[model samples]
Target: MQKKPFTELGLSPELLKAVAKMGFEEASPIQSETIPQLLTGADVVGLSQTGSGKTAAFAIPAIERVDGNLRAPQVLILCPTRELAMQVAEEVAKLAFFKRGVRELPIYGGQSYDRQLRGLRDGAQIIIGTPGRVMDHLERKTLRLDQVGMIILDEADRMLDMGFRDDIETILGQAPAERQTVFFSATMPPAINQLVKKYTKEPVNVRIQAQEMTVPAIDQSYYEVDRRSKLEVLCRLIDLQDIKYGIIFCATKMMVDELSDHLKARGYSSDKLHGDISQSMRERVVAKFRKRGFEFLVATDVAARGLDVDDIEVVFNYDLPQDAEDYVHRIGRTGRAGRSGRAVTFVAGREIWKMQQIIRFTKGKVRRERVPSAEEVEQKRTSEFLENLRETLEKGEYKRQDTVIDQLLDQGYSATDIASALIHLLGGDKPAAQPIVEEQPRREYPNYQSREYPKYESRKSSPRETEARAPREHRESREPREAAARKEFHAPAERREKPSRSPRREPSAASHEEGMVRLVFNVGNAHQIEPGDFVGVIAGVTRLPKEVVGRIEILDRESLVDVSDECADQVLKKLNGIKFKGRRLNVNIAR
Candidate 1:
């Protein structure tokens, strides 16, 4: 039997138009089953994974039910993290866009209370926030829930894991008894069931199985690596794969900070997310990541919970999670909405057992990959340099630079030497490896590093001894800035006279061009869409050459293709009408 579209599911015309504009043609499995019941004003408990379109499942129906003229908080959504709260608020705002007098506000810690209060005063009909900040507002009597018609608990499992049940119950008790309650979680433990029984009055139960939770298109794998060599392997893997956007999961706040700093130092556009960072900083980091300003984000489990950014091509587990469930959540960030994604993990020594435990708990398999060798890293670098060099040569923008190369050759420099110099100028140096230190072994864990502390009888020291313990390097004199500058630039005038003629190419058709459209399809290599797939589709459907198809970005959920002004209309018409991978393509010009 053919399934009904969202338009046939009793959605308002404005909502259906908004969904169509957002590029959703049909409802997801969970949405198809849940939205009708919720629209009827019944309590609902939805079990699904991250990126399962749960936000819209509840948000659309809630927005439809909201009485825009009331100008009071009619809907309340509780998320596990501030980031998720903001994301939910954004989605709700989109659904309520065409609906007049409807407004949604996101309230969370690290944001100025005055700003939120001002928004509330101006009349925000829906509120999405974290438990602590919501509780704060409730205590101050700034936020009233006496008339709230609907309440939603998003990621309820995560909230319980974070120990927010008390706050949740307190807030729930403040709402009207007749209000509709909605609980959505990835997993339902006994405690979650208990909460459902306590708050909901015979709610409609919806459970999407765990296997169905993950997108089957995602390709998951792991590598066995030594602890000391993990960073090296990660750099090598990043070099080898053509990753669009990826998230690296760490086990602790300190690890997120350290790993992010190290990746940045190594010239990777990486960001950090952890509990220690301020909420405003967290917002800024996530915004930059979504804007393509950063390609990699190093985050701990707590900071990354409820994050639902799509287009992530890969996920890296820097450190295995203690709880197996977290592993699912970490990788679930990618491979969303029927798109393929890759999940890679690094396991060291005793961590292999933990990996096995995760596999057992999730009923999934992890493919083993060898630690990348230095030779592999060198080969990858060489290949990348050659590709960039070829692009420069073919683009015809370097014609003026030929005179400079001729002059260098006339000065008795070999072509090989000139090429080597150019490579060095373009950041071709290999990264230095860290030194490994050996330590004593422990009994329980044979490979664990053991540190010995001095006995109390032998540890006494005088003030003079303690002072002498400081590193001798710290006592050494430092160089004066003026003297160092003078010494370093002895031939400054001569260097200026014969300046290097390696000017970077300006943005052209090769980089950024006007009147071109960027469209992302929910398919990629995992869906068997290669460069040919992009070229063939555009050239076959529209009157354009395969070469004019600007940068073909292949992500997990979608692939972005740059279409010239001449071919935009025909390309959209053909691609939208055609079906790929047994699903209708959701192609639209990106903002």
Candidate 2:
């Protein structure tokens, strides 16, 4: 069969043009197979792995069917995580780029609900969000699905794994029963199959089997390093390799900003892109990066689809992507248009297992390499400086300086001394050596050539030995069976071990409560810590139920939360030294 182009899919002109601009001339397998079925008003089940273009398959058809004039949600897509929700929303936006009056909103946890409420009030035709956040809006009566023409469960398996089954079912039940349901999952376990049977009516199942991710031209490698040394190692790699231009993929917006700022502070030209950056700012950053105004652009996966630059020589995975397919996407940024590229990933302890999974899924070779040492970095920089000097001398561009050099030489300055002085003047300052922590030495145990077991020996105990081993005084002091049972039932150890605290109470607005002590956390409004987030962290850290946390009071940069006096000390201990959203939480009991 002849290879098909996107035109054959019968997509709208606007969507087709958007696809073309996105550098997609032909429909991917999932898109080609599912879009037509969806357009025909059939409930569809898409079985595809990450990076299989499942987003477009659903997004294109959804955009096509959505009534642009509708001020309410015409489509609702549920994702398992905020990042994935943002990604799906971005793709939907791109596909509808040329379609006027089409609006998409992404709602997820950890973000201010006020922003999401504003978007909802503004009439977004397409709503994409994580299950928890979507449920939150639904509970608050801020989001409605009455007019939703289609419902999509993107990464359905992931949502289920994250314990969103009840939330998803509730949301789906709230939607119009006549609305078309489309589900996409990498695997169809019995739970997912049951969900499909219950929700979808005669769904068309489209399974796009996994294919090997083969980008032979790209050299893939990883280096094992501690979290603290990652920055130092990254800088050394960049300097030692003399990387001209590159994209560094961080996992979160905070990481992107932090890494970008750190790189800039280290005197490297760098910028950042993430969901938090406005579209105009993002466009500006991308434009500058394309023009080589910056040597590095740190970004999260949210910005992955928008990056189309082909001259990127390297893709540094400052943090591994959450999805295995994203690994392919991150590295695929390089080695474009048949040009060789390099992908270097930094793996922390135990993260190697995750990387191994990626290797297996992609069937790609990722060679392990050692991080460049301080001495090696210095040597490489020195060599580069000498080479640059050699090039400058060959170009003969220092004619004006020759007069001063000759005058010094006439005063008995040797040519070597003059060159040394010039080298000292022109060479860039070397970076301070990063402190290295030594690994513990491995101990080797002596190997025995032969195993020696003591010869088996048996002896019979005499009647006198048995009598001597008996506890005569304890036997005489023993009580009758009923008395012994009563005494054991009233054991002091049991009484002491019984919990004295009452059941955990829900956090309230009140500042004080009976039998509870309030604790202060050194992060509040400034850090964007919401009551729910605070409760989540408290529960997560202390293993206490949310109901146990009482009376949360958020101050300018601190928060006071009341907990049972019995567990206040324990809560304080667990909250200490923990970080949330990149800020340390210095938790202590309120005086």
Best by lDDT: 2
Candidate 2 lDDT score at position 346:
82
| Candidate 2 residue pairs that clash | 504-548, 505-547, 508-551
lDDT of 1 at 585: 70
Each model's TM-score, in the order given? 0.43, 0.48
Which parts of model 1 are misplaced by more than 4 Å? 1-4, 212-591
Which residue runs does candidate 2 get wrong by more than 4 Å? 1-8, 20-27, 109-111, 211-219, 223-357, 363-378, 384-408, 411-417, 421-591
Residue-by-residue lDDT tens digits, candidate 2, 337-373: 8898999998764355557757878778889998778
RMSD, every candidate, angstroms: 21.5, 22.3
For model 2 the local lDDT of residue 251 reads 64
lDDT of 1 by residue, 1-591 (tens): 122468779999889866654434456567888899999999999997554457888999989988889978989999876546655665676566677777788786555667679768877889988787788789889999987999999889877876678889999999999999999998999999999999999899987654522224567788875554566668778877756589998765555755675576455789998766899999998888888889899987768877889889999998776445567888899888888788998766535655665676677767887666657666777787788889987986664677899999999999999988877656523342222212212211211111232232343542222212334432221111111011011111211122211233321223256767777677753443444345544554443544457766665346668878677777788778565444567777765
